[model samples]
Target: MVSVRDDATMREALTAGQSGALADAYDLYAAAVYGIAVRITNDHGAAEDVTQEVFVELWQRPERYDPGQAPLRGWLCMIARRRAIDWRRRQVTRDRYTLLLAGQALPAPNVEEDVEASTMAKLVRAAVHDLPPLYREAIALAYFYGLTYREVAVQLGIPEGTAKYRLRTGLRRIGDSMSSVRAE
Candidate 1:
């Protein structure tokens, strides 16, 4: 086992593709990373996920950390913090949408209205499923996931304009499909 005190040597070993260095780094930093993630996320499961993500990122891209810029622990903590916050943001968005969908006021509790709503929802889901992969992803992220176009762009790693375009185009196709379904 490498000495945990020698971060520079550990980083060097990691950069040189040494697997033992990664295990040593995890031993030295996992608790600190998990602590930061739990503090930010307030969820043990999410904190564990964030901690795992931080370590996996470090393993995949060891060069992203410059020991000259920051200590390894600090770098790992920062990554954990960011991942935890992102996880929290996604959770908030999901909860908000779930509540919004659940709390929608029904139309006087009529059987006809309920049937229509169910049918429409099924049609929309079918249309969404029929969309191209990129369009479907954009629509799902923007509408179903309650993300703004910019957020969808960031999540999809696309430009904001592209996200907007895909969303617009996708919704138009879904609308057209619904129109045809209604006509039939």
Candidate 2:
């Protein structure tokens, strides 16, 4: 468990609105956050954006963090997952909408399929988003970005088992989310 003093230090740094403190925090966690983002998007640009967004969010809404519940690392990872998932959802929605508007009906999506695809995608994204950053990133790299688990581990600087664990957990979460969406 992280000591109270450590948590207090972080909270104080954040609450004081110290820009340098935020930088210190970022330096402490940027690699992990960037690894998570890169694992998800598989694009350097997107990962960088996600990294920046995560720190910016921390700066903007430090109150959302509760040291009592999770350590600082976990909190940052959670935020990183959320931002990556949101980015994917928005990207998918925009692309799909653009394609549809362009009069390219590749498939006849019945109301159910259409709604299910979009809504389930959103829910699945959210579920994946809520996962621990490591797991979320592993799953994103393997399934979403078509990378091998070995590649994921290499990219994230984690062991192969860890990468596989994240992939499994992420897939389970996505499956659960899909089922929930279908039931709705």
Question: Which has the greatest TM-score?
Answer: 2
Question: Which residue runs of candidate 2 sit more than 4 Å off their true CA positions?
Answer: 1-5, 107-184
Q: Estimate each model's TM-score.
A: 0.55, 0.55
**Tens digit per residue, CA lDDT, model 1, 106-176:** 33437888899999999999999999999998887666444568867876788999999999999999999
Please identify model 1 stretches exceeding 4 Å from their true place.
Answer: 104-184
Model 2 lDDT per residue over 1-184, tens place: 2232375577677878988778778877788788888877777898899999988888988888886665566567767777888888888788889888999865554898888688767887788888877778787666554456776776577899888888887888778877876787
Residue 145 C-alpha lDDT in model 2: 45
The collision pairs in model 1 are none
- Candidate 1: 10-residue stretch with minimal lDDT: 140-149
Clashing pairs in 2: none
Overall local distance difference test of candidate 1: 0.83
In angstroms, the error of model 1 at 70 is 1.0
